[model samples]
Target: MEIRLFQLLVPGVALLFIAAVAVRYLKGKINLSEFLLSLIFWMGLGVFAIFPDNISVFVAKLFGIKDNVNAVLFLSIGVIVYLLFKLYAEIKENRRKLTLLTRKIALKDAEELDEL
Candidate 1:
């Protein structure tokens, strides 16, 4: 199949997502493994980005994987799962902090009442 503009978009999307994750983690001050894994991911994305669709199809066949579209789709699922877990953990931590703060405020209020 001829590589059309629409086909090129598959790799572009992957690269964009990789960029977002990289920026987010960097801003969060995460180190080492995260950066390395992101670098590897960006490499795969770069393969798809720098080369045409035919190259990906050839490599995918050699690797016993699916076509470029399916490969991108599958890769996206992993990103989605990671984001979901990250969001869940963030929400849980925020809730814990909120609860702790609420308890502290209530205790302080109770102390003030006792003093009055």
Candidate 2:
């Protein structure tokens, strides 16, 4: 089997990220679920990079895609959309919390001024 530069480089980078995530989890910076999810993602990335053609072909068949390239593209876009949705939801929640906190502070300040 022929080894490509990207096959080596991608796995190396994935390993680094996996180690970082493990360290973070050990330090209590991330929960078990986050660590496991990150571990799975990085391992899958490394495996995919190492055997791109084989994995892509499998994915294509599984998704009933005619072409492997198209299958990869479709999967990538789906993941990106999901992440975007999650980010948007988090941002909306943060905005709502901030608005409530601001109103509470404003009411407290107004009450203090009325006393003065």
Candidate 3:
């Protein structure tokens, strides 16, 4: 079995990200759920990088995919779409909150001016 340069490099990068996430978590910069999610993602990335072929083959078989490449592509697309949906939802909630806050502030200012 021949080891490739990327197999080592990718895992090394993943470890660096994991360490960064741990430090942020310890410093209370991110919540517990965020920390755990980051940890799991980084760990999985490192493991997948180290065993891409084996994992891809397993995924292909598990999903009844005819080709490993196609399986990976589909999996990657699914993850991206899920993340996008989550981001969109967060943004929508933020916008709703901002609108409510703005309205409250505007009403308070109007009342103060009228009192003068």
Best by lDDT: 2
Give candidate 3's error at residue 33 in angstroms.
Answer: 1.4
> Over all chains combined, what TM-score does candidate 2 have?
0.86
lDDT tens per residue, model 1, 2-110 = 5667457767776787777788787986676877777677667666565656665775676678677666566578788987997899999999999999999999999
Ranking by TM-score: 3, 2, 1
Which 10 residues in a row give candidate 1 its minimum summed lDDT?
47-56
Please report the candidate that would top TM-score against the real structure: 3
RMSD list, candidates in order: 5.1, 2.1, 1.9
lDDT of 2 at 15: 100
The TM-score, computed over Cα atoms with residue i paired to residue i, of candidate 3 is 0.88
**Count of steric clashes across candidates, in order:** 0, 0, 0
Q: What is the TM-score of candidate 1?
A: 0.54
Report the Cα lDDT for candidate 1: 0.74
Residue lDDT tens for model 2, 12-103: 99999999999999999999998998899899999999999999999999989999999999989987897799789989999999999999
Write down the lDDT of every candidate, Cα atoms only. Answer: 0.74, 0.95, 0.92
